[model samples]
Target: MTLSRAESAADHDRTVVVGAGLAGLAAALKLAEAGKAVTLLESRRQLGGRASSFLDPSTQELVDNCQHVSMGCCTNLADFCDRVGISDQIEIHRILYFLDEQGHVSRMSAAPLPAPLHLAPSFLFLRFLRLGQKIQVARGMIALLARSADTPGESFLAWLRAKGQQDDTIERFWGLVLTSALNESIDRIDLHYARQVFVEGFLARGRAFRVEIPRTPLSEFYGPVLEASLRSRGVDLRTQTNVARVVFENARVAGVSLRTGETISAKNVILAVAPHHVASLIPEENRRQDDRFEGIERLESSPITSVHLWYDRPVMTYPHLVVVGRQVQWLFRRPAGNEGYVQAVISASRDLSARGAEEVLSIVRAETEELLPLARSATLKHHRVVTERRATFSVLPGVDRDRPSSDSSTAGLVLAGDYVQTGWPATMEGAVRGGYIAAGSVLGLSPAQSLVPSLQAEPTVRLLAWLAEYIFPTRKGTLG
Candidate 1:
């Protein structure tokens, strides 16, 4: 599409955004809405980066890299979808199902009660955990609610043990939640992020725990809708465009150099690409001098594996299930129109990477049969394994210190990615928050000023949180 009159007027004042992931799309959308001349560059033909979908040759169906879900607390992501006019395509499910090895299913749904207690009734009746274990888990939740800050270099695993949680309680309750939410093991997850997930997602608001899943494939959800929105705002959206490096001239940002030996000149540039790509984009001398650049390189990524299975008939009765005490962490039924397809997700799947596809399938198939009785009789039509080696940055203890903010030392250069310090874990919400922060840096706004507000806590919930903090003030020391 041709540029609008307003875009033409501000063509000289260009802000170039690299990477077309959620971060880049959010940044570009904000700048375009602000009437800034924007150019969004995406290396791949698809728009949603890791969140995008692909066409499987074997099944000839659009498949998401992994099943991505958003909670009600993910306000920025919800806002982005609404802004892009794709909000109707996402369906919110309030009931969450958890299945154990013995095929017993436990449903967790919100009641009419207030925050922190709305889901307590269902949680207390979970069939997977014994009464004693449930009580122990409840104590852990209270401790998490009362905590003020995270201990540096401490993992959630250590925190749970210190809270008097045992193997059964930790694995069935804590692991089930943290593994799926953070996409990392409890031993490696930062306590701050773990607290954020529970406090915001579970304890803060009754609606916060409701999960939202896209009704369509991710590509259809983000690619076309986002591209149309950007283009309508007169953003120059370029796909299959590889950026060679950010051209820094005289200690300031110039623009980006394309791999085709072409350079796009701009005063402001946001390197919203992956962390590893940042070092090569800058000059060698700048990399040596900049501490943030060095820290970005030190950040490590965790893996997620999605196993797609198709059967002759429906194998799962529920839309999704949180599989406990197994390598398979979550199982999801494909959205409507695809009845027989089910996707199993294994977060922190480094061990599975070493296995062959058939072996992996065998193990997953066995687990599926055990969890869902219908799967045992259904015929396996097709199967595919998709493993994202660098799915998300590991939220390890003390790792947030290494996460770079939107502002770079170099003038006119900004950063945006899930790996950036967004206060949340590596999620769609965190990504959009980083993008907004980057745009704010370019538009002379504070991070808080640019981002959308989180879902508000009820008055009673807020008072309880305050009391917890006020009564038991946190001290600077590691827990046993």
Candidate 2:
């Protein structure tokens, strides 16, 4: 039976959203909030997509596919949680802990100062770097802040070298943040995005540097809580529903065809899935003719590895730790109510991904013990290693130009995903922004009207950022 024949004429006005990830959820929520009929479709039985969790067959406990984190600069993601009534489920941490291989922990918290300077106080105390090294790092940051425009097709590593940043400074400071945030090597990341990360996350405001982490399992957090909330808002939520292809009429989207030989017709369709999945949905002839589909093939993905370990006793005292100069980039004490269970994540783990699971576990366990001495006394009760080979799209140099906008050449078809040009990296915030922009396009609303504003910058901070650009305005074009 056709979904169109099963509904009233009001169904014709419904906007069908494919994929139930953050992007799709955001788009559906915005459309529903606008009093527009929304039907959300997900091929998976559960929601949240990559930011999801599943039952461990051996332990029968919930484990996330990855460790998802948010920062103070992620206003759109915070807004989405607020709108969905899960704001309280997120725990805000003012202090960030960084642990060295020798188990020396350095605490980083903002001081009661203005933007850019707020973090300066704590940065001075980091035990990982020497005083001379910190001064050099500070100079590199000033250069990063002062630059006005991006050098097209330039890697951040090249830009960093041009600023006279030493190799030690790049690895100890710049690589520490960009590798985890962008999920790509510093050498491959675009300079434009690396600058955005620092300016918005650290230099914009004092509060923008704070961290936000969920206190519950992703499956429960997104499954019941978000599902109920979206459904309550009159959204037709369907899981385990797959769309075979988008049916177009005269180069316009009329509806989507299901794998089950059924069709759901709609006037507005938002393709919120990954870039690779997108081309298969649109007809070959249309994709060949559309500029929106161009260059999508050039977009590549990065990998992330998460290692879950359950010790016989509590080994980690801190809630989380940023492991400096180690293959295990970030470690989190699992919030799944399992005592002694913790997860270690390695982003941009291409080298590690090629290793066997046992080898990966061994490396992670050794690193954890080295960083946290208490782990040496604890017994490994159980363990699991999960590697998402295609975790996020690589924000490579010149890749932003290939990122299409929300509007498509095919009428009534909108695009939404972290891969879109959301002016942010492949993060939850970017996904939410993409969804809002796509929904905004459908409603004919401006980006300002549809999306939440970024954290306000201090007056002096704005002036400094502006002055830097004004002084170095000729830093455009290709940088060798």
Candidate 3:
């Protein structure tokens, strides 16, 4: 049954946001800024949900479960940082260095060219490919650019294969990009999302250049920053509270039932929770009664594991690097004072999750020694393992069909999550995009005009003309 008119207007003009993750906090901030009475509820005492951080008792320092990085195209997330006043707490890099299984290092940096052309040099110098392989990779990228953006295309792996990419090329280069960007293999990722990642990450000139990571823990980076900002704007943030169920009187949502049996009435309710939690909150009658959530069942999830090791000596020269041909996909060096801390992220991980913490740590140590020789002789002070079984929705074949719209069927009830059909993978970009879209829905505004500035580069044709000289590299092209 849906909610009655009386209940709908019980708290007219007020909006309640469930889930205190990025999506929920983003919606609350947006709605509150629009002069709407907003209340945010989080089940956990602390915010940031999966992005939350914990303090290490031994070191008395803060640490995040995983190391997350964002690129220049992630305008929504950057805007979020701006909104929360923590933009300065994030550091951005212009160059990305890759370390292959063979211990060969290649640096991908931006060129002087406009948007997409700026990436040509980095592509040419990539050590993972041979001279012929580099040409094939460029040709494949051009073909991808030529494809229609609106229609769903072939699997990324198939498209590469059709472009004559060898198995070795895919394993050495394409696999690393796909696995890190989508948290799934190339063969399994949806073409639409993969294309988006490439377009925003590589094709855009200055966009692909700026890679940002939080200098602090997720909570400090977002939780308190958002909470203070929202509260200052008069948003009500309820923590450690569970919404028993949403009350529907007629065909609309009336209010939410709290664990205390108290009902908080609100005209608009944004179900900013994950997809798996939606079925539990919505009324049984209103639900489709399917085993899996509709419009999202096609998406499956893969796991990611992060192993943290504290050492007496610094083990890495750079803050982060992508590892190829190893169990360790990415390694981040987080140094606090004299203590050296490192986090190794295993993306598209399955078997690693089943292993014990000690086993995971040992593998991470071995892998670290291979990449950074300094780490081999360092004394291990401490180790911790964090695993997110459903770290992100698998970007498998036909996954686009299962993506859900930001707007919900029920009035005043919207869905928000990285998995909610954002045309991006379940990365920070997707989560922030979903939040921005959902916030627009809550404020009855067009998503295109949200607070986040658009990062869409000019049409490829126009950009190409302006960047012709830089696009075609000569033998004399300077690496520096």
lDDT of 1 by residue, 80-149 (tens): 8889899999988999998987888899999999888898999988999999998888777666776464
1-480: candidate 3 lDDT, tens digit per residue: 233345444257788888888888888888888888888999988887778788888878777878878888887878887878988988877778888768788888887776566788787888767898777777656545543432354477766675578888788777878887788876787667776777667775566547788877887887676778889999899999998887766767677888888777777788878766777898777666332357665568898898888888888887788787788888887634544778889888788889898888888888888888778889889888899898888877677678787776777677787877566778776787787788888777766766466476656633553443344321221110
Cα RMSD (Å) between model 3 and the true structure?
A: 5.4
What is the lDDT for 267 in model 1?
Answer: 79
**TM-score of each candidate?**
0.96, 0.96, 0.90
Residue 75 displacement (Å), model 3: 1.0
Off by over 4 Å in 3: 1-10, 289-292, 335-339, 451-453, 458-480
Q: How many residue pairs clash in each candidate?
A: 0, 0, 8
How far off is model 2, as Cα RMSD? 1.9
lDDT of 2: 0.87
Which residue runs of candidate 1 sit more than 4 Å off their true CA positions? 1-11, 147-153, 469-473
The superposed Cα distance between candidate 2 and the true structure at residue 156, in angstroms, equals: 1.0
Better of 1 and 2 by lDDT: 2
Clashes of 1: 0
